[model samples]
Target chain A: MRMAELSRTSGVPVPTIKYYLREGLLPAGQVAPPNQASYDQSHVRRLTLIRALTDVGGMSIATARVVLSVIDAPDRTVRQKLGATIGSLGDIQATGDSGGADRDEEHAQAAKTVDDLLERRGWRVDETSPARAAAAEVLARFDRLGHHRVIAALDGYADAAELTASNDLDVLAGIEDEDELVETALVGTVLGDALLAALRRLAQEHVSGSRYRTPPR
Target chain B: MRMAELSRTSGVPVPTIKYYLREGLLPAGQVAPPNQASYDQSHVRRLTLIRALTDVGGMSIATARVVLSVIDAPDRTVRQKLGATIGSLGDIQATGDSGGADRDEEHAQAAKTVDDLLERRGWRVDETSPARAAAAEVLARFDRLGHHRVIAALDGYADAAELTASNDLDVLAGIEDEDELVETALVGTVLGDALLAALRRLAQEHVSGSRYRTPPR
Candidate 1:
């Protein structure tokens, strides 16, 4: 299909499709000539995915690109790939591996950064240094919070993400298929937003015991 | 205080602080004269909030700005104002009320967009068409998958977010402090992230015994 057809089918504007191509968020179509190209079902899939990540997941293009790299990277396990993807959430700087006595300089700096932010809030987190303690507390709180059901969903999500990532990796891996990779990234992102949004609404209903609460509750 | 002093106290670098000011993420300090500005405890507090929003909360500058607006907006109930703040996360598209319906177009568009994304992922959400049903399901799963202890924590978290949002709204209400409003937004974003990440981890740990598993015959 031509770009126009692709745009029509995907509900993305033609100019935006061009922009995705330029940003390396979409792969190039087969060159029919110097100025023209052809797209396929893969293009539709990829475009859909791109929209998902950007529109729904709210990931920056650069972050989206990094995630795409993991989906397309061969020689990496699902866990490793996901870790790399999660790494781009822009927090969680590397310390030496978890359970290591020594922390890396980058992680140490990030920890300090996080701590300072916490102390500024005047929230008490038990520790010798408020900043370090705050960062640790943030991690601890993740453990303390309830709604275990969400975690199970996350595990399922992780599993789904893994399966999708592997499936995508197999299709795009080692093929120099930037377009396919972008498509995979887009799908992952869009689905993630949909899933989370859906879950959030459900959770709100059950937890809050109201579909929409009246003001002043 | 000198930049170094501020850096040590805030645990943020002078360069980074400068970056924040330059980016308008933080309000500028009072200029004493040429080439000199004095920052006080307020600046320190502001910087701390800035860090929390950016790093811990993972909000974009634009989103952060919108949040701050709510915090500073005057003459509104805490509940009312916080609802507006939370709505920002949905990336609500601002379409002029074509005199059709207040939020109808926006919600419909959002739901349609959300629905399309979910359909691509093969999740069987009912066609009530708002995508709210689907979202609700996801959240329900979280509730089910979550550990017993986690529900207690989520209760606290929901309380915290609600409480913080309400009180923060009241404190800055009727003042039109865009900075404070943005600060409120930052708090919401960061706190939300912190709460969810914590919940996700706990849920992940207890997925086996929970009702989240496939029902056995």
Candidate 2:
């Protein structure tokens, strides 16, 4: 198909498609005679994935480019691709020791808490995984707020997280094509957070409605 | 304490503190003398919440003000306050029928999937809950990407979400003070999403490592 058809099929505008092409977010289509280009089904798929990442996942174009590069990399194994893809999504800064002694102590405590949680669950994750730092930052935020009660529920949250992660992997296990598997994994990891967060709010509303229903005047 | 003290205590800068004050994100302090005003513990707590909403939660100042107002409003019940706070956070536009026929049909189908999921789980969320629309949007994105397998895992995700929501409310149940309860709920609801997303990534890394571990070359 030509650019117009590709835009129509992918529900992206032509100028936006050109912008993506310019940014190398989408690959160059096959050049036809007289300066015309032709796009195939893969371009359509790439456009869809790009929209999903930027629009729904709220990733910046630069981050999406990194993720796409990892996806398009031919040499890496599926596991390595998956690792890089997840690493690019969160954008959480790693916990550092430069915030003076008080913060350094707090960050150390939070890191220990995360380390202990991983140990208690016996989960095999790299020490430098951005998720570890992200989780530690959250713990530090809770501590700063003086909400130890929330921290007390860490085990429950971990249990739920593990269950959801298993479900995520199960979905990926069913996909046979390596490219589709990686794409689906990236989409699932990014959009899945929004899905779970929305569902959790719905569930919270349900519980709150039943538990704290206001009586009629 | 005064402005400098509040800034030092909260680690928010003086100009930013002034910005929040001018923006009505913080309440006015008591006039102590001819030129100075004095702030108390409440100012510090408010500053912490303000920073959490904007910095950690990534909320706009306007939205943060609305959330803070809901927290500060004494006339609303706990459930109403919680509902309003959650509603303000996600910022998801509700599914509408404005995107032509095909999109309208897709959105309607997505909405049905969400409604059925809620019914299947016997959840009592309001029809207008933003989460319902947010979840539906995620489903629609998956549909657009042609990844139905992710949708198939919705039940498992919901199960995990319910468990985590239960844990959230249990923590809220332990807070005796109503003001503190609302404050804690707001913080938990906002930051909990980040925490859970981080933990899920960690869990995914663990599962992927164990299942797809690359043997030594």
Candidate 3:
């Protein structure tokens, strides 16, 4: 298909698709004699994934580029690809230096809490995984706010996360194609967060209403 | 304490604190002699909450103001406040008109899926809750991508969300002070999303490793 057809089919603007090509987010199409380029189904799939990463996943182009590279790499195993993709999803500033003794102590405590949770659950995750630090940072912030009760619910959150993660992997394990598997993993990891957060809010409303609201006569 | 002290205590810089004040995110301090003002512990706590909403919650200053106003409005019941706060957290553009027949059909299917999930779970959430549409949008995107497997896991995700939400309300119920309860609710809603996302990633790693990695002899 030509650029116009590609744009129409993918529901992306032609200029935006061109921008993605220029930015190396999408691979260049084959060019013919008058400088006309043609795209195929692979290009369409790539465009869909790009839109998912940027529009739905809320990832910056730079981070999306990194994730795309991980997806494109041929030598890495599926587990390796999953780790790199998840690593790219986190904000680097989250676990950066705090430069204060109080913050350092709080962070140390938070890290210990994460470590304890891992040990209690007997889950095997890398110590240096960005997610470890990211989770700890949230714990530290909760502590700073003097909300120990929220911190106490960590195990419950972890239990729920374990259930959801198992369901996520079960879906991933069903995909046979490597490209589709990685692409689905990326989409599931990113958009799944939005899905779970939205569902949690809905559930909160349900729980709050049941607990507090008066029953209609 | 004064402005400088408030800044020092909250770890938010003076200029940023001033900006929050100018934006009405923080209330005015008590006026003193020579055009000086004095702040109290309340200012420090407000600043902390403001930082959590913006930095940790990834909320815009305008959204933060809306949430803070909901926090300040004294007549609203806790359930009403939670509803408004959760509604405000979603992006307004998500459920807007997609201007396409295909998208409209997909959205209709997604909405039906959400309604079915609510019925299956016996959850009493308002039909108007923004989370319903937000979750539907995610489902629509998944359907567009031809990933039926991800969409198939919706019930699993909802089950996990229910567990976490139950844990969340338990913590909130323990807080006796209405002011602190609402404030903690705001922080928990925002930061708890991050906490859960990070933990889910970690759980994914563990599950992936356990299922895929070859054990050493």
On DockQ, the leading prediction is: 3
lDDT of 3 by residue, B37-119 (tens): 89999898787778776666666699899999997888999767866777888653442122468778888999999999999
From the highest TM-score down, the ranking of the candidates is 3, 2, 1
Candidate 1's residue-wise lDDT over B1-217, tens digit each? Answer: 7666776666777888888777766777777766787788877766656555555555666776666666657787765564565555544221211223522443454455445544543333334423354443322222322212222222223332333233333333444645444443334334444434332322222231132343432
Q: What DockQ do the predictions score, one after another?
A: 0.10, 0.52, 0.57
| Residue A64's lDDT in candidate 1 | 69
**Which ranking of candidates, highest lDDT first?**
2, 3, 1
TM-score of 2: 0.88
Q: Can you write out model 3's per-residue Cα lDDT over A28-118, one digit (the tens) per residue?
A: 9999868899999989878877877677666668788889989899899986886688788765344212247787888899999999999
TM-scores, all models, native as reference: 0.52, 0.88, 0.90
User: Model 1, which residues run further than 4 Å from truth?
Assistant: A13-16, A22-24, A33-35, A73-217, B2-8, B11-36, B92-189, B198-217
Ten contiguous residues with the weakest lDDT in model 3 chain A:
A90-99
Superposition error at A208 for model 2 (Å): 3.0
Q: Cα deviation in Å at residue B126, candidate 2?
A: 1.5
Q: Which lDDT tens digits does candidate 2 get at residues B27-101?
A: 989987777989998898788777766665656689888999998897999868877888887566332113557
- Scored against the native two-chain complex, candidate 2 gets a DockQ of 0.52
C-alpha lDDT of all candidate models, in order: 0.46, 0.84, 0.83
Reference-based lDDT, residue A178, model 1? 50
Index of the highest-lDDT prediction: 2
Clashes of each: 28, 0, 0
- The segments of candidate 3 whose C-alpha lies over 4 angstroms from its true place after superposition are A1-6, A36-41, A95-98, B1-5, B31-33, B36-40, B92-98
> Model 2, A110: alpha-carbon shift in Å?
0.8
